[model samples]
Target: MTNDDLQFAHDRPIAMQQHDLLDRAGFAQRLALAISSWKNQESLVISLTGSWGSGKSSIKNMALEQLAAIQGSQVIEFNPWQWAGQDKLSSAFFEEISRVVQRKNPTEADKQLAKVLRRYEHRLNAGAAVLSGTAKWAPILLGSALVTTALGSVAEGTAAQVTIWTVSAVSWLGSLAPWLKQAAEWCTKRSKNLDQEAKDSELTLSQIRAELQKLLSARQKPLLIVLDDLDRLSAEQLKAMFQLVKAHMDFANVVFLLLFQRDTVEQGLQRAGFDGADYLEKIIQVPFSVPAISSGQLEAVLSGKLDAILANEQQLQQRFDKAYWDQMFQRGMRPFFGNLRHVYRYASTLAFHCRLLRGTEVAEVNAVDLFALECLRVFAPETYADMPRHKALLTNNEPFARQDEPQRARINQVINHLVFLAPSTHKPATRQLLQEMFPTLDWVFKNTEYDRQTQLRWLINSRVCCDDVFDRYFELSVPEQDVPNSLLHELARRIVDSGPFTTLLASHEEDRQAEILQRLFGLVDEFPLELSLAVVQTLLQAGDVVGRRMSFTNWSPRQQVVRLLRLFLLRHDDEAARSQLVIEAFAVGPGLVVVEQLLASEYALRRKADFGCLDDAGLEQLKSAYLCNLRELAERDPEAFLANPDFESYLYDLNRYGEGGDEGRRWSERHITSTTRFLQFAQTLVNTRSRYSGDGVTHIDEISLHSLDELLGKECCADWVARLDTGELSADASQILGLVKEALAHPARSETAEWND
Candidate 1:
């Protein structure tokens, strides 16, 4: 088999049948029993309610399928949403009833109704002659036949129009003809004693009941109507169905199983003319709730699928072990438990990835792999279309916004649950968290990056996690708002422990930590302040490699030691706080080399801040501190530094303190003075005519000095004069001309320094 084929094998979903996949064996049994209980009864109404995708429809389908197989009963599936706003609900009822009845014995109903239709057609063909004599029985026959024949006839084409109209008229008679005939007879008898119009309007409930009883008793098998997708129907439609059931309880030996999403069904039930629970009790004989799969079951299911795939690739089979599955679910998939829709989506993704990897074709993925992939899939949107949108739109007042009171409350609850997943140590941006927590909203705001105003609007609407505060530059609330605090904390824990959010955080820690530490340090590095000491301490104390890369001390001006000591003292012996500061300081140290560069530096060390180069406040503080030190030095050693030969060098360093500003000019100025001094001092050190020059103890070759003269700039010569200070010009001053000739060979400093001057 090609690698692709093997890959496809592993990519098969862990479970294939959604309708039967849920472990609802017990629930299914209960539903079947309920059906059985109502099968022999005259009539039964069942309302199946559960959360969306809670297996209400699945269980209902299962029960009907089983009933059809075991009891030879007729089962019909109805969607009330499709029949909404119909003037006559009775037609819809029969439409569904016709579907089920036709399935049980198509020929019997078809032939019986067809014969009745043939007679009606003949009467119509005979025109007014037949109609005039048949008028008495004709009206009743036509009305009964029209209602009965309309049954399954609606589905047939116009080609069958005559047959359909005939059958409909006949079927109508089959169901209500007897009642109509008896009502007419009774009306005729009663009219003799009373007014005809008055007697015609006087039908009794007993007559209707007797007719319904006769029709129901004639059926051998019960009618099973599966009302699926009630959850999708509007409240009005659901209420109408309830009304129909209540008004016609003794219609037939029928079982109406109404299926709907649990919460939606409950809400619908409440709106459908009865209290939610009370209405449910009246219609639902047995309510079976499908529970979520246990963590153990999830693991088992993944392991089983992985094992099957691993069978082909023994080399990678070892990776699909049980323990592996445990870790994957615990770390990767457990965070998402809202529904099976997500679980199945995650599994399919993992399988496809395993197929993508040609060499390590783990046809089977353990629960761990399943979960890990799930996390990756959640974090990475290109793999699934949903995540990118969540990341994009979740920020704003659009759909994700915390605006709609109900949705806002739900978003708050989700945020509260997310507390354990926030990245406290390396906190992610508000948008990042919201995307993962609320993917739907992210999908909405894909391209609002350039418009800060739009982005802000989203932030206000969603108020997702700390983003609401972060956007407004609000500090985390003190004493912690119970909901947000728990949510942020949990989010931190979850991101660190498992999930795509953590992977993304780890991937971008360097840049993000640098940014946050820079902000936090700038705020408190020099001055003391009370913030979330606990949060800071936790992050700084984690000692993660990423955290160590940040020098919190450089974030502010005070001595690293002093800042910690002050915070410790002011905070009243906060050991956690103290330890955090101490550890960070110890990790970063006093900056002895960096300090010397600040103080006695030879080359000018520019402060990034001086040129507006310090993008964040942290770097700006370092600039502030360096400038402060320079100010202090100028105050204490003004005259010594000015009189000292290196005084100009000191000033030059200060001038070049920022990037590229004034450094070159300062060098030129200082070099001009020093170069002039060296040239005059060089004349005193050696005779112009002599080839040798020396300090008293050491003689230097004259030719060598001439060569050095040509090689070194006037600036270097002046520096040499200060080093080898000798007095008087040489007797052979004219010989200086030759040395000047050599120096003139190179570029002259100015027009005045000529070779033959």
Candidate 2:
């Protein structure tokens, strides 16, 4: 589309070709006729007041357009902000007025009026300059005046007073003469001929008024000078501009329409220590505020923009059906639509991103989600920043930590701030919009719960919100190339179809394969349960494909597969399925690393109260599978198994299970194999005392004693206990053996004793 096609109604005031959407109150028509039908009233100042971006400019433009059709009316548009920092506002105002007045067919009377206005302007400048100079030396001038007055008064007093005052005057004048002469010369150089200057200044306000009337008497139309964007001026400039219109711009047959955001200009005046309300009341003879835009009108305008952008894309357009569009408009876009400018800004951002991202083959993005994200990005940037950084919280998959409470509170505060800051009528809907955008916030706001599937669907559709779908949207550098969406879709289809894993692997480079697999794994969480199960099953059966690509990096194919399994087990609430999956993974020989991953996955689920995935039977089965794998590894290559980095965690898991439940006893018995191996394990624990010095000692001590007691009768281990009493063993070893001896001596009392002791 061309730039003109892309422009929204509010991008510029309703052009000649553009229809008026904001003249709902007929304020523009009334305003135009008001200016056109002006009688011989003194120069009138009419103010069009509204908040910034509240369609004031558009309304003014519409009124001016209407005025164009009125017979004999001449309109001049002047923007004070345009001349900002250039010259005094008063001087610029008169210059513009003169320029406009002089352009009335160049009649002799118009020429005289322009010439007289310029002369008034020059005289005003000269007077200001003279006053500025004189004010600078007022102290010296005052001192001389006081001295001369005292000398004159002394002559009427006693002889002694007269003599004293004469002496004082002489001393003061002797010190002040050089400064006085310099001040006089400064004034003389700046001053014009006194008599002629007075003659030029003879143009009084009344005479200027009469001359303006006489000049406009022959004209067929009234004069309308529209001054807009006054709020854009600096505080000093704003105050000066209004003051100039009040003092000098008042004339018969001329109408001045001043447009600005009321609060902005009033605040500017207040900042400059003026009674802003009173000042405005005096300057503006007729004040009219742009009425609020109706929802029907706003929706019409927004729909127009949306239709223009979506005109060519039937598929994208279908996504925004009537009900969906209405909901989104009322819930998302409508509340934030403060004015035409707001609509333009939001629509522009939506159009820009949609144009850039539409029809991309690599990412399966939803158009509505993209629009919602852009809305947040533009109107509520802080909320947007928080959303992506805390996605887990938004999705309710994770809770905010104690340390994050402050930030959570801040995010809530910002949301609340935006809610209150929104228009009062829209506050309720705006709050709902925020909750819809970030559902995790509902815990605090107590809003309705959004459908998780729908939320995830929307999230995955936008590149900004879904990191797995595409490269970071806000990153500074651009990617060299993006993976095609068609390729990703095909890869997913193949995996779902139970196609050969190596076929997929052989088709792409290792890195690309890893990214493809990662993206596939991302779908397990975003899609439904059946689809997720299919993805998990595909990964499970592709062990050889994954193993070949395993590397030290965390994102290797094996790790990706392992993570997908963990996510599946954690995310699905079926305990039997999770148990079966764990059993199958171990049965397939998923190495010691995958075993540890399974253990961690279960532990996290239990910790987060998300353990619906593994029931009692499933738990027993998972624990059994875990112990049996470790037992075989220990028997096959004990040293390598013990030397594995995950060994301690495995041991900890064993201790955790053996301390409670029937499966604990069976797990310990099945794993402890022989007395010699039990003793060897006990010895290993002692040798690694420093490693288990802190909280580790508790689990190690308990497990060591329990294993020794179970493998050998409690009484038969007396010799082992004696080795500890003889102090031949280290403190940690002795500690465990001593606990065994105590247990044999008094089982009940020892059971009650703290493990640390």
Candidate 3:
């Protein structure tokens, strides 16, 4: 996705010091040292507890690594979560420990003790299996009565199934007296033998217990059984596990190290019908709370991961300042990370997003802004979710649009409610993070707001606070037709080369072409003078292409360029410098469309006095230049000049600037000799409007004779009309002439109809 190959950070625990970015080894070393020195001959259950993702498992691993260096200690990991929903976890756990002790270089004596322990567990297991066993449907004949009943009660006691079956079969043969006598004697003899064996085997459980105690005491090394992820178990599983540990408290030289979140385990214990506090208190011989990871350590972990990822991405690194990142982390981002897990989670998420955005798009966005916003997204999703909906209020600097009090209040209410999702300790920092992104949002709490430059810089730098670039961040791709500021800046820089820029602009669809001009106009209004001058110059040349597609109405890209010119001119207080800049611009011959636009604006200013930017002498200079440029164009290409869409406007400006009296008509006569040229001239004088009837009929209004006489001399048009041969004229030319002369007598009043665009 990017040239810089960003890597994801895994969420697993750090098993070695090289991966320990949080500096947790010191604490783990102390724990291992304390346990190794303590000579507890009997069984001990030590709990190393912390909250979820607080590195409880990591610290346990570190401590065990240190303990492995000691002369006489062995570690065994027992995972009770995997054995959940089983019928005999207790027996399974005993069998596991006994197998471990026996398999690890055991002596003859150890072998005998392990064997006895295994046998005892098997016996208990067999007893439990018999109590739970299912029996098929069967009937028993008891003293001439047939009974169908469950044998569960008898299964639980000493009454055996084999003995009952023998009695039942012998009763069926009661007619054979000798066989009945033999069956009765055999049952009595079997019962006496079972009684003798039961008396002899009464000490089996105690004997196995004594044997394990003796064997563990004689061991050269202490057996350290480590159990992790205990908090992940269900209520019933937690109860079973704690009961197993409680049952084995009498074993000498055996130590069990338990790792879990204390609260979760307690909650599960309470759900399983035990006083969680008391139950844990009885079983836990040594308890140690995993040290609270400091905020600095958490920040270090996050920074390390981010730095590693950023090191791979050079574009981000070029813009990254350690001082700024540290400051932002301290003020807002630091509070979002509460543990090592949070750091890894955020790093992995950031890496994935950075990789998803292609290089150009990544370069278009500011790195710090991306980091802060991504921090919001990962740690506080609900707060981030509300951001894009209020893009206008957050980014728009227009004075009128920003005065929506109700909308601002709703945003304020939403921001204030963000505290509910965040922890109490980090709520203020969370608000600060938002305020930093949207300075206008500060008005809610700080009674102040940022000025336009702050917002402008955000737009120019492609920060999420800028409205145009904001959605690109959330959507993770640039819109197809939209122009990103990166490419726009490049275009502005290369505007001096009008060849490529004009060609590229023309290649787009008409709407997108207008959109490019719109963006350029904004740049002309706000960019530095050096670049703005080049951009306005380029727009003037490009406007001819865009203006051809436009209806010369409100959405005219040509009109937007004029407005930008006004904005630019008004920015300079000196009339001379501004007028000189515009004249020089016109001197370069930026086409007829833009020249007429400026001159027309000056005429409007003279009538309404609603604008500024040029003086009378400057206007005369511009008029002289336009006249010279206009004459040269007519002399250079007469047919092309006459066929131009705005032929009427160009001729009017020429006559207005000309020494007067039929100069434009005489010039038009050079090219308007044929019906084709006359038809093109008539095309410029018509207006179309929707009729007032409900049937949606449109009426084409034409200029009256008097108006035509004022523009073109009456004698000039009368002579031309007399000279035209009706037979030689094409059908289209003849129709246009009829329409032109049809309204000459009545003189229809032409309204300034709005363009459909």
Candidate 4:
């Protein structure tokens, strides 16, 4: 089959008998039998009544097919909706009948009947003209309304107000214009001065009716006229149609199978001061309400069609399961439809949108979620429109500040109203469906509550409920700057060195880069069970650049990468594999910072053994490797090594591990020859306190003598301070010297002050 054929359904009616899915052909069989009987001499008007979209057109077509079996039978169809405006509905009706008669093997009696049908229409118009003059006051009344509006506006209004008032008056007068028009159309059915021709118009209509009945009686078979979509016409059009059947066409061997909603037709009739039910009773000889479809049939047909729309695509099938289908479709989507048209309409929409998302990158929107949202879109359309506008409140899971709690609660109330505000019949079921979509609202509805961990799983599953991807379902495609799941999968598969990874992230705007990194956080959990060193190194390299840009509530992208590494390590089934991956990455990896922080966090978690992975021995191996990598980096490029953002933090961690006291002193003296380099390394070690006094905030740079003595040795610092070129020193350099001189002159304290970073 061609791709276009498979892409979407046209929602056309079931025209042929074989296409009847609801067994509605049984009603068609009964209708055909009535038309064939020809039991009455006077014309028969049978109504095939049902609500709109109840498959009336489809059923009517099936009946017409059944009628085709009868030999010598004639059929004519009138579509009043085509000529809805103007006074041509009645004229068009006769023209259609005459056209059908002349085209359909016209016999002598049929030719006379066709000519008389035209003459009778002219007679009816002539008689209708006599009553038109009685309603001429309607125009005078409308003219008075316009004149009053103009005068009132001129007396108390500006130019804009006068224009608006005139427009309102014209609009109000237009509604009565049709009614007033009937009054101005006058012809004398019983005139004095206009001569016998005016009064003869009424007499001529009677003679034409007599001739029409005589011509129609000679027909061998009934001319069955089917009028579908009668409810689609305006009240005036409806009135004209009823008058044509009741007064003009009560002849022998003619049948009308009128398809309309009973209530709507009655409403149209009521607008013309006729009791609609009573008028229909007078015209229709036999009434057949279209058969009600069983709910089982609707579900079965929709399920079969949904299968066709979804097709056999494996990617879409993976997102759906029997349990989800039961909750979302069988229970959630099923309740909204009341008839066959609703079912077909939903199937058509599903087909079009499902095709749009067919080859999307890495299965962007969940197919089942699309079905759920489509249900809302088709049935509760107002709420569906609100989905994109209220995306934040609907998908929110993060806790808000205490001060903002009331505002959030108010927003939650609005979200809650969506469940309650549905059409009364669907309200309870809508809540059931919405709970499946946004489980975070369970607390408000007294359902089982979901935690952040559940929300995390929703993200990994790429559900419509996930805030990261909620807009995709509405937009029907991945947006610009969006981290499509396909792209992430490709990135993970083709991962290379840190430079490429860093460049890929840096290519986006800063916030978009943060989104890419955050999505990577979940991608870590989704990584294949086999943890590769290339993956680890790429993240380590990429993370080196994921610095400070972030939401305050979220960890910086750099730190997020640290969490990603920890999750990456935890993926291994073997404990030794996890510890070895860290050690291996550090050995070949550029920086020791990621390894130090990861192992340190694991070490902390080990005390509780809740999230910890390594034993004390494996932990010590990672720490030692961190120190080794740090010094190796310094040895290779001291300038770049000293500039590392994590250098001070890693050094403190190294000292805490009980392996950095002497090594830190020797490395600093060798690499830190200049006074500038000395202050850079020493800043973290000194305690800088701020005190507010008469003198604006002064920095008390407390240089502990014992801290220097324990780590770098007091004598070593004093010697470095004494050798400073005092004359060429910068402001910061002079301040560093002053602090060290004062500390070395005093008696050193016993307890050393620690590095505070």
Worst 10 residues of 2 by lDDT: 683-692
TM-score of 3: 0.80
Model 1's number of clashes is 54
Candidate 2 pairs with clashing backbones = 72-221, 361-485, 362-484, 362-485, 575-613
Clashing residue pair totals per candidate (backbone < 3 A) = 54, 5, 0, 3
TM-score of 1: 0.38
Worst 10 residues of 4 by lDDT: 184-193
- Arranged by lDDT, best first: 4, 3, 2, 1
The best-first sequence of candidates by TM-score reads 3, 4, 2, 1
lDDT of 3 at 327: 69
Q: Write the per-residue lDDT of candidate 4 for residues 545-570, one digit (tens) a residue.
A: 66644443556666667777766776
lDDT of 2: 0.60
TM-scores for candidates 1 onward, in order: 0.38, 0.57, 0.80, 0.77
Instruction: Evaluate all candidate structures by whole-model CA lDDT and list the values in order.
Output: 0.43, 0.60, 0.68, 0.70
Q: For candidate 2, lDDT tens digit of each residue in 474-513?
A: 3312254544444555565566543554476556766666
Candidate 1, run of 10 with poorest lDDT: 470-479
Per-residue lDDT of model 3, residues 468-556, tens digit only:
67787788767665576556666555566666767776777775665555555445444557554555566567667664555433356
lDDT at 652, model 1: 44
lDDT of 4 at 443: 58
